[model samples]
Target chain A: MLKKPPSVVLASFRPSTYPRGYASALHSLRPCWMVFLNILILIVVCGVSSAVVLAEDHLAVPANLQVFDTPNDGGQSLTVNWAPGALDSPDVRYQVLVGDAGATDVAALKVVAEFPAHTRLVKDAKGAWWTRTAERNWHQFTIRSGKAVELKDGTVYTVTVAMLKGEERIVGPLLQAAPTPNWFNWNLVNNLVLTLIFGGVVFFSIAHARRRDIFLRRIPGLDAVDEAIGRATELGKPILYLTGAHDMSDPSTIAAAVILGRVAKKTAAYETELLVPHRDPITMAVCQEITKQAYLEAGKPDLFKEDSNFFITSDQFSYTAAVDGIMLRKQPAANFFMGSYFAEALLLTETGASTGAIQIAGTDSDHQLPFFVTTCDYTLIGEELYAASAYLSREPVQLGTLRGQDIGKAMILSVIAIGILLATLGVATQAAWPQYFLDFFKDVK
Target chain B: MDATIIGAWVATGLTLFIFSFLYKDNPLFKLAENLYVGVSVGYTIVKTYDTVIVHLIWKPIVENQEWTLLIPVAIGLLMLTRYVPKAAWLSRYAFAFIVGVGAGLAIPRTVSSFILKQIEDTIRPLLMLVPGEGVTFSWNLMNPASSVNVIIVLIGVSSVLFYFFFSVEHSGPGKMVARTGVMFLMIAFGAAFGYTVMARMSLLIGRLTDLIEYSDPSYGRPTLWLTLVTIGTLIVLSRRSRSEPPDSH
Candidate 1:
């Protein structure tokens, strides 16, 4: 400025005079500074544009968000369902968020469950009409959250689904629902219907049986009971009866007790020694009374020894060991193992088999049935264990129950046949109608 | 000696004593059996006291202020009245309540679990061959499960169910079905027997492993010492019994 320097020099120059090398250094640094500034501006502009693109690229919100109380529950669960949006990809996922219905900020809500994309809906429909009308194409995912997730009965909750694609998220509109307790679940209507039908059949059969005589098929095992007792009487040895390892409360034990009464009466009539050992005290007491009553009925009350039905240790293996010892020592002519058995079944049956005892066993215990079948002279498999009481007692009431059970089984078989036919047709034709038949047996809820 | 080592030794001794019954019933086995019974009974009593008396009865009534719990307590106490000959009849009330409640609870669960579930599982698609893919009719020795297996199951189930139909006489075709049912039953039993044997062998192996662990130096080889002692005792007892006269019943 002092000596009317050039415009370029004036623009680059500071107020103070510089050394000779400084001007050249300043000129070189000026170009570097301009380049750095240009780069910084470019980076800022690109970052802003990228952020806008990211926000715009987010997936569309899921449609038809619905919330409702879970049916057939103890009023502690809520179900969240939503129709999936257009965004379907491997990288996409959905998360269910739950919050108080009155909450102002959706972002503050808690994420209850997260599911991968294309989660299939669980159908809660029954019968042909419902199955036909059900949505087949649209994928609607449902999530059930219970009280364990802080969901309470009677409290309204707002449920929303969020689709997550990469780092971007778009949430659907919230739907409000409250969980209410139901005394009778309509979802279990099929179960109720079946039960009532079976119960009514049983009752009707029992009533009908009282008025007329019914033909009964002979059970081969029942035919051998008297023969086994007679063999024991001839051998001058005691008859061993085990009511199994269960308490009196078990149905098998009740059946055993009933069968034991029949056996006791026969033993009492023949004057054959009877040995009954029990693992439970209650069962022992009940058996003692039953034996006494049997003896009384047989007109040989004095033959019913009080010591016959005695309590052994409640320990499983220990009782088995004791029974095995008795089998080895007493060498009972006939051994009757009735009711339920477990791991000790083989141990007991094997010991009895070795002692040359005529063994007959009946049990509903499928696991131990093989042991009984192999080692014992005869075995009553599964339902035959239940049928033994009626077979031996010949009570009208019991016979009616058995007949009703048979009818129920017949109904089940017919259903199975129909189901199989429908399933085959469905597979061959690729038709949806067969699904209605299959859905009848399905517990949809 | 460490407490844990002593416990291992005791356990090993008891296990060997119990196992000694395989030779013959002896005093040692009887002692072990009685000890087991005593321990189990004691444990049961303690558990009952904790669950029934303390938690269910006392805690709820006192801590939770649930005074209505007395009704159940009174009913439970009545169950003990059976020991008193004069008031024995009173126990029937408790028995009735228990039986009624148990029956009410069991019926629904049994229907759902046993009956309905079994039917649902049985009603499955029988044919698995694809239409356009063409049938590959090769016998897979390793995997017997196929459409044929489904047919076999259906036959087995229906035939067995038919056999149990007491209303139908086993005269004509019924007898044939019943015989087939019997064959199926036998096969099922054979498989179950094989599985049970495997299970029992596994239990034996587990016990043998425990015995081996107790044979370690830290346990002072309790299994070995116990085995020797049990064998010696059994020998002595057998010799004594052989020397004595048989008791007359």
Candidate 2:
């Protein structure tokens, strides 16, 4: 119970916070000798330093205490480990106590976790060598903010592992650590490798496209673009076009806008009316500019109606209702539903279908693909929507990017085949080596 | 009638008018559609006003003294310069900044989350290692993660990837794989259609239940009176339509 600043008896017990290596580092100085030497030095150093004394000298102090920041996390966590002491038993409980760094008050540390000895040991942890200890089967525990003192990022915390036998308590030397925000997570290295490979492929493909012709197979949905515009022109009716409900930020919406330029060009050449309704103001503005540019390129700038690409309500069903109203009243000959859609996809496409219009839909949102496929005369599947622009514009850069994406997909397919073969062989042989391949592809930690 | 009953009658009347679209487009349906659009737009404007002007911009600048918010606010205002013909070029700066930042931020996350994660999931192993029973190939059809289902999924995914490969032509073995991919796609769509039909039926049930509740004597039977009023209005409108000349356009 002698708590008069136990720094005299326990100050030497302070293990250096930063360690050169994680094993056999903490010096296990005898408590009796530490007290004798600490007093001998403190008597010469100062009276206040020698004021403290020891309690329960026979209690076994655990050794090799280590506290460090949890690696590869967003921070705010510290891990603690201490070797199993001589008092380690099945019924004996181990309590992990924590406090601010340089805390001298022995009783002030808060116990964050209490568990039976031999439980939560390094041996019981994951079978990775990185997680194991080289010296002893040390008891391990993680300290986070909750049910204990808050461990903030960039703040040092002192952790001590204490063993409890009934009412008897014995604590290890205090170890300090500070949680820090790590800029990069090494856990997602596999994902990074895949991304780098795909990026390199894209760049190489773009460069190669400069010299050679890139072959692109036919997309039936894109092929009907001309036919749909021609039908609207021959019928002397306007073409109703939607640039989807999303803002300009979405890739699907961007693709839709690019395809809109091509459609506007075709309509400008054939002298057909085009109506582009938008749910987002930004997309409306962007599409308006695209339509104008398309018309100017086609030598018919006068035909580009500024009001043709208009903003309806941002609310989904309200936009749907307004579009349905326009469909009924104006009676467009062909309808184009492009970009990402939500529940309103079926509502718009179904109404367009009932009107007997030559409907062609394109969207990357797989959830709405079923409705579009059923309701529209021609439907572009997921990747086909992205490819629609390159198919229409025949631009080298865009075509190269599309071909690169296909190559990436091919790489992925090959991986799946190889992964399956590896996994099958690994299972059949009851070997652990296949885990390296599996872990390399594990997208989630 | 009480205001609650009156509101109920209006709501039921409007709902019925929207339902009248199944018959044909008419003045009643158009009235409901216009009202819906107007109310929705009004609600959205108020919400944006509260969130953007009041909560985000005004309150922070006024109370918290967050002057840095005005930098982005100025950039947003720059987008409005497109209306001024002389200053129209300035709007490109705002558009460029937005598109550039949005694409830069979205590309990596999209690759990691959508592309990489999808590949990881699609390339799963065939056999499972059961702890006590060694390697086991489960044939349980009910378990989606069973070995048989894993092989099926592998085939489905591979064939689909092959079908979408634009660089390669669909011929010989590739054609058969493409056909398989189409079959899988159709099956997925059929299941989705069935699910949607069930969802739509549930929505219908909910509406019908609400109508039944409004038909209670406590609510003064708004559903019954509204239906009669709607039917009477439709009859009168049709009679007038029959007398007048049809729209040429």
Candidate 3:
């Protein structure tokens, strides 16, 4: 049964003791009470301010919204202008999306215009057949601010704007404006081969899950984890596990935590010391719980040390440095790195190498893989890191998801093959045959 | 050189100095590594104090003027109480709060992102492919090139999603679909793998290219020579490891 949280306001507090004559006790108590009362007063003030801060959020838009006179030297393209949205401030970059009403339903949805808020040009797309007039940065684009759009002068159209900030996608309340669709949009080919390939893998995994015959290529990096832990036990040195700097929200961090569970169990069973240094407080707490559970499962609950998994500063390089310091001082015989890593990957790997520690690393960060592969004894690449957790846990849910992903990969492959064949034939024929392929693959904003 | 220019040169020089480890480690690399460690730790301390203590803790009380800060304060204190082995159970409350909120945020977002959005996007308007004119699979609509591409994309998307679905059994037609999904997945993974391999190899090539370019200068060649010498020394020392007397405890 879950316990209800203690009510913050109603919680009891024990007053500190003051053993003395009544007069003296009263004198000392007066100051304590005064300080407590002052703190209470301060809390009330702070509380209101904090609430205001939370409520102070407003959509950030750019100050300058205007039209650019630059015409497309080639054709009917008109330069649309707008200032950045206030929400992004000076730090965020934006994505520009353009949608047309005559297009498909999804296309009619307000496309991200300038996301970072700095882009100033958009080509006019209205034509006589579509009969839509171009509108500027108005709520409803009808009048093409001094710019003439060649549309049947009487048709109505609507246009809207949306602001994108980082990963936070926010569409501005729809601004209705009329805009004629013009300019040649290249036809884009869907990524058929890639899709087929993903599909195939997922299918086979699921099929095999039933018959229990799926042959997963052995990842040597995974195989080495046990050996690394054992080596540390033999050497009487602690085993250090570094979960990537990202918080628990990142899939990579979750993968790292899952891996930690396995490593913790091994350490518990072997009676070897395990150390996990975390940069995020929440990740640290989760890891501590996982470690404790692993030890408990291994019948070594008494040996689990809460302090073994602790939070370091969240700064990337500092966390790296602190781990390096730990490496130098404790000289852990084995080191495991699993999760997202960045430039500091090299620094940490080199330090481990210098210490002659056996290191195993797994991460999805494409940029950092090279350093890890060269330095670590074994490394899980890209998606394989995610797969490792699913593989180890063998929970039905994880297995099911893995099966799905496999299918996605297989589907991707088939489409690629088909696309290649068609493109080759079109080229051989020297006709408009392959034009369809080229058109379908064209990128739409 | 002006001081600023000299500083730039110094920083660049140090970067190159540390980067030399790809060839072999030396005292220069060690020095740069130590400096990096020191500076990085200093930076982290400032960030942590600012973010966790000042913003999360102090600001609520001193600057933001909030009584509700007491809730977080109490939770934080509860977290610390876990250190006391006797009262460790109390720590679960904080954990529950953090985890519950995190889950609340994650479930909706993940469903929207990975499941709903992706799935919805996959179900494209199939009618768009049908020719408005004559039938017989109008190569106009059925441009073998684009048609094949769309079909492939449809197959990939469908199979991949199908593979992930746990409720249904992948048998008969489902088996075929699932198998196809796996094959497609492998190809995609293979392509991704190939790309990653190329990327990593490129980095290695880049480093080597830089080293080769550096060797063109007289000052740089000596650095290279020094690196080679250090590597040679390390190799000889490593060979003597077995024969060396054991350290006295």
lDDT of each: 0.79, 0.83, 0.62
Using TM-score as the measure, which candidate wins? Answer: 1
Q: Arrange candidates by TM-score, highest first: which order?
A: 1, 2, 3
Which model scores highest in DockQ?
Answer: 2
**Better by DockQ, candidate 2 or 1:** 2
- Quote the lDDT for B71 in model 3: 88
In model 1, which residue pairs have backbone atoms overlapping below 3 Å?
Answer: none
Please write out the lDDT profile of model 2 over residues B1-249, one tens digit for every residue: 578888888888888998888777888889999999899889989999999999999999999999999998898898899999899888888888887877876676777677666766776557877899878898888988779898899989988888898878898999999999999988988898888879978988998998999999898888898889888988898899899998896
Judge the docking of candidate 1 as incorrect, acceptable, medium or high: acceptable
Q: Candidate 3 residues A1-445, lDDT tens each?
A: 0121223322424443655554553675675776686668557756766676664454444233332222212232223334434343444544333343354343455333343443332323321112112332221122232223332222333333445555654443333233335343221013233234444665666666766634344556777888999899999999999889677767788889888998999899999999898878778988998999999999999999989998766667656756777787789999988998877787898889899999999997756776787788888876778777766666655675676665554443444455555554654444555544433432222
Worst 10 contiguous positions by lDDT, candidate 3 chain A = A126-135
Model 2, C-alpha of B218: deviation from truth (Å)? 1.7
Candidates arranged by DockQ, highest first: 2, 1, 3
Instruction: Give candidate 1's error at residue A95 in angstroms.
Output: 1.1
- The TM-score measured for candidate 2 stands at 0.81
> What local lDDT score does residue A426 receive in model 3, on the 0 to 100 scale?
56
In candidate 1, position A41 carries an lDDT of 56
The interface root mean square deviation of candidate 3 comes to 10.3
TM-score of chain B of each: 0.88, 0.93, 0.67
